[model samples]
Target chain A: MREVEPKLLKPLVAGFQLEKTLTKYIVSQHNFLYCQKAADLDASVGKTTFTLLRQINELQKILNQKIMLYRDRFSEADVYAVYCEHPDYEGLNDGTFVDRIEDMCELSTKCAIKEWNKSQIRNEAKQACFLFRERRKWLEIYKTIHNETKTVWLAQRHH
Target chain B: MSMPTIPPEPHRPNRKEVIIDLLESIALEEIALSHILNAESEKIQAFVGECLNFPTKPSSKEIIKFNKGVTQLLESVVMKEWILLRKLENVLDFEDDCEPHHKKCESRCHCSPCHSCHFPVCKCRCSHKKHKDHDCYPGK
Candidate 1:
């Protein structure tokens, strides 16, 4: 396995601070507005929003934990090996992070349909979409790092 | 006798228009950031793929090249993401500036009491034909 230096790995795990900003400015705004006007919405819409918000909150927690884990645990290891071994990264053979993004999108659409409140639903949907897109982008980065590191490992083995 | 000078009507941007402008700006900035990120990702992906062609045991030259590629990737992608967050924050801050102080009704007419007119029924001079026959008028 190719052991990359911590400094090199640092950038890969960078930008967790972004989640805080997004939550503060975007997600929380939607939440606050929804809470204020929720009484007027249909019961079904309220339930859906509740589920959607819960899902978002859970996803945020998981994402934050995963980023921190990556920063702390993989100080000096092959990116591929780490991904393969880490429970959070591997996700118990579940489909890649892309699958979770698809799930979120489905929920977002459902919430939007039920609520029909543009101010309450659309901004939250956008924030969720952007967050998942960011996560997926980072996943690609990890995979890229993994492929290169794998190549380096093979070359080192040969050497 | 000197003619009395008339001042230009002070421009009062519609609250909805102001909000829409801010939102459009935010959307444009987001699109720009997304494009920058995609380009940076492509650059890094290509560079990493190039690393595969290095010799079994990279010489000092190859090592230096690889390190430089890694550093550049970090600088480009991470910095761009940080800048995106800052820009988004600024745009969101502008939202407060556009928010109407008066409560808006839940209709598409986009009517609100005119702050300057101080009339209970003045719907901010909305041109909605539905309101044309309404008893309310500006300064009435």
Candidate 2:
């Protein structure tokens, strides 16, 4: 069996298109579901959430272009064939490159969602506080009215 | 059929519950990724070891080239990770908290970007002695 060519391996150094991986694993698989759920629950938050998602997507695209440009400065193939030249290369169990691209992307969304949830909670708490204050004021007014009516009824009974 | 009584209000999902779910998922992902990165690094290291271990040693030039390739691979990995981490931090609004300290600046200190460390300049006016010479002093 021909040993794994170093030339082929060299491409892998900077080769795996992370943008594509993130887009595939994150934007396509994860974000769509989250967006749908967020929108279903709340419209305003859903709009902001979509905006954040767009920013992330744009960031990925810009970085992808930058990395590609930087990578272009280097030659594609070089004389690094020593690994393949080893006699026992065939016996060597070169483990598979398990790209944890999904996990990383998932973490990104996890963080983004967490922030959104925090802001949502904050807004909810604020609104709840306002309602509580309003209700308290009404309760005080009702109590005063009840006290006046009771006093008038007692005087009438005494008379 | 007899007239039914008024139904109770539908249960609305609590914001805290959703936040808790998000936090849990984030924690789980971090733990999984930590292990995954370590495992992947080991695999790469093993490959590099095999490349170096030879019956008849190759020329110094070839060895250097192989090492260079390995370094480049590792560099790419680190860069990718850094990018993702920074992006994550940005998403979470944790950019103000610089690394090493990672503590919020209590005093009126502005965190300027230091080109050397790529981390923010730690002029947090904290107890940590100011390294004026190098704005991004990484060490304690």
User: Could you say which candidate leads in lDDT?
Assistant: 1
On residues B1-140, what C-alpha lDDT tens digit does candidate 1 reach at each position?
99998787788666555544554553454445445544544543343343333224445455345434533443444455445445544544444333343334434344444445422234456454444555554435
Worst 10 residues of 1 chain B by lDDT: B46-55
The deviation in Å at residue A77 for candidate 2 is 6.7
Q: Please state the error at residue B90 of candidate 1 in Å.
A: 4.1
CAPRI-style docking class of model 1 based on DockQ:
incorrect
Question: After superposing candidate 1, which stretches have Cα over 4 Å from the reference?
Answer: A1-159, B1-15, B48-51, B55-59, B96-140
* Residue range A1-159, candidate 1, lDDT tens digits: 224433333222223333323232222223322332332333433444444444454444445444544444443234443343333433322433334434434444544344454345556555655666666555556656544653456434433
Error of 2 at B48 (Å): 41
What is the DockQ (computed on Cα atoms) for candidate 2? 0.01
- Residue by residue across B9-93, what tens digits does model 2's lDDT show? 6975453343334434433443343344445445334433433342244454443444344334434444555554444334233
